[model samples]
Target: MSGTEALIEAAKKRAAYAAVDEFIRDGMKVGVGSGSTVVYVVERLVQRKNEEGLNITCIPTSFQSLNLINDGGLNLGDLNRHAPLDVSIDGADECDEKLNLIKGAALTLEKINVFNSKLFVVVADYRKESKVLGQKWKKGVPIEVLPLAWRAVSNYIVEHLHGKPILRMAVAKAGPVVTDNGNFILDVDFGEMADPLKVLTDVNRIPGVLETGLFVDMVEKAFFGTADGGYVTVDRKGERKVFQ
Candidate 1:
């Protein structure tokens, strides 16, 4: 890997470890989110579960996370038992100053985990920090749509929302990337978003658009592992705390 790539990966590990250490505890029902950074979070959870004997049940937000929880030896939980989670720890593609997030997915499934959790915390490397929604993460907002509705949703986003929706293609596969719910994802370029919540509402109004990537006012705290090996946190109060 390139030097910069190595640094970012290390940073992700640091952020993931720190977040899991602070938030998870015995008897807590935690929501495990998706993405590369969350991989480290699961690793730390496994360590704590085995070494410290931490008793916790994990609710996965994605198929990948479900596998991680199962393979890591953490107890798996469903919505019925763990809906009101102590906390949900997730990774952001881009987190703006207000802690709004982008890079969306699994419409109903992820939201099931998100809204049910009491506190939602985000973890990421420095590369994901942004002053606004579209600043750092160039990939447009991901919008999940029903398989049959993909074309119409894409067209609506362009004509009404004034956005370009690109069908996300699979890397190793032949067709479009199918979501866990068997839906299609359209990475819609809304340009630099002015108001994330507004964007979310406007996009959802489009028929067939299940959910927009925009996460507005849902974050309680965000832990960022900086490129220089320092850690910082942005809290709900919009305050930055550096761990020295």
Candidate 2:
């Protein structure tokens, strides 16, 4: 990795490690979210489990994280056995000042992880921080929809919502990216949103939309890793505590 890439990786590790230590406790059910930053999260959780004997059940948010739990040698748990998780730690592509986030993946954003957990926290590196939603992370909002309804949904978004909806194609494969739930993903660019909740409400009214990556007013706390290997904590009230 280049020096800049190494620096960002270290920043992600610090935020992931600190968030794991601060939130996870013995005997608690934890939800593991999927992303590159979450890779470091599972590392710390496994270390704590082996070193401190932290007996905890891991609830995965997606198939990717399911392997993360199992391969990491953590206690694998499902919602059938572990309902009402104590906390869910996730990563965001973009996080605004008010904790409104634009996430990339969503297999269990609404099903169990975000809704079932008592506390929802986000972790990301410095590059994800922004005063507005699409300022830094301009990739747009990811919305998961039924495979057959992608065209209909895109039409609605473009005609009514005035957003550009592009189907997410696989990087290594020829076909479009298929979500773990066997659905299609559309990254809709609505421009810099001033009212994300309004956009979410509007898009949710459309049919065949399974989940949207717009997580508004759902995060309880967020940890943003800075370039200096420190982190910034944002509470629900938009209060920021810088830890250097």
lDDT on C-alpha atoms for all candidate structures: 0.85, 0.88
Instruction: List runs of model 1 lying over 4 Å from the truth.
Output: 105-108
Query: Where is the poorest 10-residue window by lDDT in model 2?
Result: 105-114
Note each model's CA RMSD in angstroms.
1.4, 1.3
Per-residue lDDT, model 2, residue 171, is: 100
Output the lDDT of residue 49, model 2.
88
TM-score of each: 0.95, 0.96
Residue range 1-244, candidate 2, lDDT tens digits: 8887787888888888989988899999998898988899999999998899999998888877888889989999877788889999889999888888899886445335888889988899988988889888778899999999999999999999999999999999898998888999999999999899999899999999988998888788898888887888889997988887
Reference-based lDDT, residue 34, model 1: 88
